[model samples]
Target: MLRSRDDKKTQRQKSEVWPMAKAHVYQRDHINTDEIIPARYLNTDKEAELAKHCMEDLDAGFVKKAKAGDVIVAGDDFGCGSSREHAVWAIRGAKVQTVIARSFARIFYRNAINCGFYLIESADAVDKIKDGDEIEIDYDAGVIKDETSKTKIQFMPLPDFALEIIRDGGLLDHIMKTSA
Candidate 1:
């Protein structure tokens, strides 16, 4: 028996999984992009440089505390204000695997995904998760499990096309591949 092409694709997609990570809880609402990366760092689009200043204004120790594969959990409007992609770069550069929030500003959400950053909207998870909590997110399944609280939260799943773009490491890469 031969497997269908779609079935084969599903197997490959399942292999592309995000790792479990620790959570960095920031409970403030309306955390604008300006506060996330700051305008001072916007002079350079270099992710590495921008990452050094990520969340420095809102949480002075964030840069120092953030580790590779850590997740950011925040309250509503986590990414509001200016449509700067710098904020997205900074967060991704910091090696934050996922950002879970109650809500997000439209611009920031698009910029984040375009930059290959994963952002999840889960109000329940935001309210329950605390700093240093262990979290495992299955992006394909749209599920977030908090080990610390033993709670499971679900988010709206992105369409297959959106997931493909993210899997290709952002829109640019996806476009490049498809265009070629």
Candidate 2:
């Protein structure tokens, strides 16, 4: 059986906007890489393995609780510790592609972009959004809409070049696409 044309139209519309993602709130600031992925678990660079230990030190059940496409809403200095890209990989491997925080460590910010991940810095959004809230982002509009609360928050959109890289799924993919 074929689906209705309306369903196809709806699918196309969803493709234009960011998908609705659940928020996982972490109110504490200065959450370091060590906490995000413990040093003990850094022996391998495998994403799934790393994900198993992501937030193990800080929140032991985070890996078990979080689902793919969920958003992490945290306070200032999120990802403060190591400059390792493993931290970014771990987060992504856990199926969490976006982390909205008050601020992120400079290295972590760069790593996330390089890894084709999203790190949104919005103190106001963090304060307003609670755990388990469903949210959607309008990349072109620079807005985050909380589907649960019917609230909206503005955020600075990534630069064109950065967005391009992220759109291609990392710097390497971007290069490959451009060079092709």
Candidate 3:
């Protein structure tokens, strides 16, 4: 008896499961920080509070739709606003596992890594993925699989050091863990 390809994949994944994510796509570019958390909500750096308002300005329904281990899919310049760490904080607060975009703002990229948030720049993922699509990301393999569509794409994963920081829960945590 021969198993189908997807069945084979399922069997393999059962042994080495990747993080599963649900895609929450925003079809626009330049989703700035202000829209991510709104400066007015920046008073307290509490992640839980910030989570309540994440993406409120840009998409009022976002908070309602988002869940832990979900993914944000967007076009280029996905964090292209003022240099505000709050942006990444809010996203993390919302329990979003990672973001897939065509590109990212330089500062936001750094801040995200520092915050232990994952961000992948993949044009194919952005273009092919859609809202509500169930996705799985293999960090080691650098692959994004759309479970809904049953397709996948490959991209370069972050370097080992950055992955270490993310795995340790940001630079500060990484430092504390390694230096202790």
Clashing pairs in 2: none
Candidate 1, residues 1-180: lDDT per residue as tens digits?
A: 331112222223224544557898888899989889989878788777888998888998988987777888888888899989888778877767768889989999888667656678878788788889887877778888888888888888766776777777777878999999
lDDT of 1: 0.77
- Score every model by TM-score: 0.84, 0.84, 0.84
Clashes of 2: 0
C-alpha positional error of residue 42 in candidate 2 after TM-score superposition, expressed in Å: 1.1
Worst 10 contiguous positions by lDDT, candidate 1: 2-11
Worst 10 residues of 3 by lDDT: 2-11
Off by over 4 Å in 3: 1-20, 176-180
Report every candidate's CA lDDT.
0.77, 0.80, 0.80
lDDT of 3 at 150: 94
Candidate 1 Cα errors over 4 Å, as ranges:
1-20
